[model samples]
Target chain A: MDRQAWTTLFHRLLFTSAVWIVLSGTDAKALAVGAFAVPAATWLSLRLLPGRDRLVLWRFLRHFPSFVGGSLQGGVDVARRAISPGMPLLPGWVEVPVRLPDGGRVALGAELSLMPGTLAAGVRGDRLLVHLLDTDAGFENAIPREEAAIAAMILGTGKEVGP
Target chain B: MNDLATYAFTSIGLFFFVAGSVGFLRFPDVFSRLHALTKADNLGLGFIALGIAFQAESWRLVALLFLIWGLMLLAAGTMSQLIARDALRERDGR
Candidate 1:
């Protein structure tokens, strides 16, 4: 499905499920209700919540795989931190240059922090200060992957590097 | 025991959300606000999730709650990073 339909479907599902929880409908009924409710809500929201752009939603889904991949990588890092025998973790702040606008920078910073071993220490202009626990593990050094992931997520392509 | 445990979790979660909001209101800058939000808000949400998880009637609800919790966690962490970075950026410009 195209991005718009997918997003509309998601919106429907989220609301229907939310409603089902509060009301406590039976299993089959809840599923049917939600199935109907979500699409209805989507239609209503589309009609009512005017001027809402779906670009970010589209971009987000496009970048979703990488985000999940990054999150999994982060989980592994946490495992490493938990299990690593005795080596002292070298924590350092590294700068990540963002070529996108402030909004994109904001989006990237938020997305990256979901990964393990990294906390957004600071941001200056379009540059984000990322604190990494295991700088020597090659993850922090290979900043391009994170950047590329963010790029895919926010801008949706390499060509539209910045705006 | 279960009732008491449930209440305790729920209360703690409510307390956390309140404390985080208070901090957000009182804090001077974006950085401090992010600091307030990340730990407390998430922990609060965690507590809320735990409370809900306990009350969940079926595996489906439990699984759905967990998924929602996971998404919330992602949002909290990411948004905080964005806030922290922007605060630093503004700080640097001045």
Candidate 2:
């Protein structure tokens, strides 16, 4: 198969294997099983899903690192709030208009929610209902800072929200 | 060694949850409050889950717990997006 196809195959394998290990309830052999099973599943899925054979590994993997990074960033934000609960938390719900297709936008939204201290409260068409931690002082003050962070994590550089 | 590590992780996890809740209650807006819940709840749950995982005798049980968590994250995240999208649409129109 082509390069993208192979890449896609590998990813599907990892995801499938992860599911397997979890379901099997055998951590003792998990790493071992995961190592091989993941790849096996990837190959099998590639064969099953007929299409352009165009694998979006980077398309998805690009977000994987953000998962860890964003979570850590969020963790710090949480810690900050804990230390100073009354610290002028900027709280407000603003809609982030999305130009992304329905699926892409939906995917992005879900990922954002996974980030610390942000919630995808609602969605109507391309509009997103986002609630920031503190909005009292400023939409200028709070929303932009956090939204920007959220945008970067979700949309990558091209999707950064305009200031 | 593993037990100690698990305990430490649990402590940190609990700490984050409390912090998030404090922010949620104290914070001034819907957005901030949401963040407080999103951030803190996950950590709180993570710790509790980790403790159980470490203490449990069966990998299958732990795996089940993890599976549930993954699904919850998926569901919650999607719901968050839907709400955000709808809210934004209403404001721009009005």
Estimate the TM-score of every prediction.
0.50, 0.60
TM-scores (chain A) of the candidates: 0.58, 0.52
Candidate 2 lDDT tens digits, B27-59: 655455556666566656766677768877777
Put down candidate 1 lDDT per residue, B1-94, tens digits, no spaces.
7677779988877777776676556544455445445545565676787787788777667767766776787788766775665666676685
**Total colliding residue pairs, candidate 2:** 33
Per-residue lDDT tens digits for candidate 2, residues A72-126, read 6666776687567357454556677655544455555666665655566656566
Off by over 4 Å in 1: A1-59, B1-63, B79-94
Interface RMSD measured for model 2: 3.2
Assess the local accuracy of residue B3 in candidate 2 as a C-alpha lDDT between 0 and 100.
Answer: 91
| Native A-B contacts reproduced, model 2 | 0.70
Model 2 lDDT on a 0 to 1 scale: 0.61
- The deviation in Å at residue B54 for candidate 1 is 16
